[model samples]
Target: MNYWILSIEAIMNTFSIIESKSDIRFKMSLDSTSERGNILDEQSINAGDKILVFIDKPVGEIRYMLEVTGVDHTHLVLHKSYETGYGLTMRKMQQVDEETYNLLESNNHRQLHQISEASFNTLFSHMFEDFSNRYEVKTEQPVIHETKEDYVAPEKNPQDEHLPHNWIVFGAPGTGKSYQIDQQRKTYFGSNYERVTFHPNFSYGQFVGAYKPRPMKEDKSKITYDLVAGPLLRTVTKAMNHPERNYVLIIEEINRANTAAVFGDIFQLLDRNEDGKSEYNIVASEEVKEYIESQTDADLVNYEIHLPSNLYIWATMNTSDQGVFPLDSAFKRRFDFEFISINASEEKIGDIDITIKGIGTMKWNHFRRTLNDYLLQHVRNIKEDKLIGPFFIKKTDLEASDKHFQKVFQNKLLMYLAEDILKTDKTKLFKYPSFSQIVTAYIEDEENVFSDAFTEALAEQE
Candidate 1:
């Protein structure tokens, strides 16, 4: 069977959805199209062909494999207006884990990828075995549930059918919290989205909307202020106007600013109803309500602000960062939290070798794993967040030579340890006349480097 990659913005964006007009992405037309039609004409995908469904935002991740049921000339939902394009009917067949999906780097470059039989068996078989026991598991069970006569079944990815509307991904620094959040919004099909980084002085007006001065077009000297929309306001405006499409609002380092103060009265809209709409609409100022209404397609009712179901709000937090605003029970309870593990990207260090002058060489992954354990074992009342992650020291630092690696150790690694971790009580861990003596001695005179504690830490295995 032929293996192909199919790019989609949403799981159910096919002409299969009733009253759906989003047909451009799923079409396989030849005469009018340029790149996409050329690909489809060459492939000539059949009913038995395999399709690896991928999200369309270039996140380089695949969730499921589906089989092409058939090629439908007419729209799947029975629309007569669209006839030039042909849509494929697909059914989810197999699934893969994120780690397994990340193994191949080729898919990162393109939305479409086709593999030969030999390439599929060599590469895909191993990855599929990591999650599911077999490369292909045949099951004919239908996933649809009948409800009403006019109800139609919408296709969703096997694993991620439902995602939390308000979610936060948290982890220690370098553990890829923001990276995780960035990848997830694509699965939600966030074509229209906004990303804002929070700082100490960020305010409600900046998060929502504010009146800003603008030079008049008629005269350069004259100026009048207008209500300018912020990230949240712009995203909400798009979501309200186009209810069919999904929108996202990303808050990077959310706790850097006071969420309670930044969100203001908008916090009341966090509680969502069964349909994913905000349970309670927060009262808005008359000016603010009028501004939002003018930007939306929906009729104005109570003149209040309510989060649309199509909008998803996500944030990332660094647990290691100091002086961050704390969230109360009420604020924290409103969202689901996902913690990224320190060992998540351990394999990314690969087989990079760092050799100390007086001591034998150790692998990058092995060194960090040993050092992290030593911090927890030897130090008193130490937190996991304080320990360095897999990406704490870049691989390039050790790729050069032993002398260059020693310089990085003395500067970045040792400096972080002295100021943040050990503080004034580093005498027991590091060996030197003073911390300043590290530059003069380059481990040439002794069997072990920095100190006995560090030497012992490096000796650890697994």
Candidate 2:
């Protein structure tokens, strides 16, 4: 029997081993004829090869470390107990040494992950503290996956070519404005996209580039300041370098921040030519110019920076947020605005039951439609803008408990009504003395929150 030993330089090959969240035990059958078994056979996995164990989603994390002990081509089968836990039937088995198995089992699968050995040691030291308490783990091994294929980029949409370089997707709360951008991003840019949410405090320094402090590598006590490019700048630099590929910069809740202030002179770049390039390019600030010159190709640093046609700028805005900074007509005209309307139609997610504790078991779709209809008709000053979208309440949220429902209602819906929608309306539509009274009535099922006037209106529509 030929045993293959891995050299120190062969540690670069990383492999992900799949395991269920309920079970972290490492058990696999190595068959010489099978695809997975072939890799183990080719690599000559021995008792000490290091392998990463990944827990599949719902518990998405690299949860355990495993070492290969004995790799058998035939007659070695996985125990039925371990096979049932992982949802895999093993024809051959690779056993781990007793001590390695015991150490992993005792830890209950605490996550310890790092890209390299040095980083792993640093992290492991802080978490475990005892340097002497090291297990005799194995060397690098080949990944168990059947095949590794490079990703093929999706075809660009012809419609996207005609669309404006800058776009603002505005909608009511939960109207899937950001979701649309995310979908478009995956279609166009694949994984090459940067997303940033614009809060009130978001500034040009944070949006573009800023001189920030960095700890000195030689001495942890010493520090150095470097020009760290923000998401927009970093994406722009990446897009400029890779002109062949499309890049997306997603500005989530764009209206949340002071648009004029956050954008500063860069707002001029929003104006695009007929060909989708920036109509007027702007000179980068001294700090930004210096950073760009050092980081990117010479062509970018030679002249004023322009927003590339291939760089798609997508932004989202919620009309319900009162605190959002208003965009002037000039700024608004720079980008194409796509308005997303509230959709209250039911969505079916299999046969899953969504039962609220006090509200009883009900179809989520029916509940959203009926509630939205009631809000639009009977709630004072409540229009489609103030109405809830179908997706606002997820099936998982509904299944959790009434507490989740109450939290969403009190924090989002009721607060919006009390603070914005019905603030100035003298007519108390629900006939509740206070907002709390309205919430109480709805929670306790003491009163029909909607008036009898809406009953006829609802029947007329039906």
Candidate 3:
């Protein structure tokens, strides 16, 4: 709370205050996300300032407003809300009247535009702090059954080719690592990114390509080498076809399988050449070679396998998962590892809850605080790796349609917290109170428990 107060002060200093209201005239648009034409007078706003909008008529709703964070001749980008963080304002453009622009410049509007870089950073520091406190719960959105096709890099030059070939992302559960990859597949993979999971049984032949038995018209079945391209093969082939387009091959649960067994000799191609040509060798295991020789007439009989320089590999693994070990030194050298933690902003979580619950009557903040505190008291002694995921606070979980929230809390969540505390025998919790009862009782008692710590603890046990 103290930090939020300080951030507001820093934000105030980022742009010089517009003291003379009469000197400048500005145009405002509130319903930009929708087709509703809700515009307001420029005189109602101050340059480089923040405001909380209150809808007074038609339908009641509240919106946060930010001044034009940046401006160009065509569009003046405005900050949508504090939820977007202070530095990331929405980009939009409006036709500006020359007379109004001249009047604004002649007045103190010019002074407001002359904000220092240091002041801008100070404002962001505060914004980040506010964002952190509000969003403690983080969950990955469901993967849509859609794929994006296009490969232009928005923030990078067309000719730039310095992107890394191998990268690793580490994060707690529900941190959007998978969701981010799925949603932005086109941006990273040049419009044709492919993904596959790596498991203990996965091998080089299975990942690169494999053949299986196909039944014929007769009773007997004949095995034909089906050169069905795996995700890795598809990604490389796509990259070869479009040099200008980037291509990504995402390996989910990379640590689950032995990298050496799966990648085999192609691991050398992990390094990228400046000209964007991947160097690969025809080094396959004896079994793979024998299989290929047996199918001489197969389409994959004579194939050139080389990872293109434009091909990128993005791998994800949970460090806390069981049987997970550090990567081999050779494997480690090929990747840039990044750690993604759970850092959600409260304002963003609040908005998400509103969308999920499809109701405005519930106080989400209260629910979040209560749920988090319950976990804290019960799970204080657990390891950080075993901490409860914050995403269960979503409004959808509380709704009658899904018992996901209840199952997670009573089963998986309780198991994690049980490692820390036990009113009776901890093992009893795992089997006691059947799944249906657990959910029903939790839903009935979540909002009705007494304030007494003992009473609340007792209620949780049921």
Q: Pick the lDDT winner.
A: 1
Question: Candidate 3, overall lDDT?
Answer: 0.44
Error of 2 at 235 (Å): 0.7
Clashing pairs in 1: none
Ranked by TM-score from best down, the candidates are: 1, 2, 3
The local lDDT score (0 to 100) that residue 192 gets in candidate 3 is: 51
**Candidates 1 and 2: which is better by lDDT?**
1
* lDDT by residue for model 1 (1-462), tens: 576654545322232121111122244433323333224543455556665544433222233345555555421111111111111111111232222233232233224445555544433333333323322222221111123653332233212456777888987666777767766655555345668899765555567764333446677455444555567777887778767766678899999877886787788888987666899987675556767878766655776789998777889987667768888889999998998887777776777887665667778778777777777887898788777776666667767777788878768776777667777676555665454555445444533445676776676463
Clashes of 2: 6
Better of 1 and 3 by TM-score: 1
TM-scores, one per candidate: 0.60, 0.59, 0.48
Write down the worst ten-residue block by lDDT for model 1: 77-86
lDDT of 2: 0.53
Q: Looking at model 2, report the run of 10 residues with the lowest lDDT sum.
A: 80-89
Give the per-residue lDDT digits (tens) of candidate 2, residues 1-462. 222211111111111111111122333334344322223442444444444433332222222234444446421111111101121001101131233222233332222221234433332222221111232211221121113363446467423557557889887776677777877776766766778898765555567754344456678555444555777788777777777777778899998877776677788888888767789988665556666666677455454888887787889988677767788998999989988877622344334454433334556555555657766765656657666665565556656666786677556665665656677651344455467776777677645554455434444553
- Itemize residue pairs with steric clashes in candidate 2: 29-92, 48-138, 48-139, 49-138, 49-139, 50-138
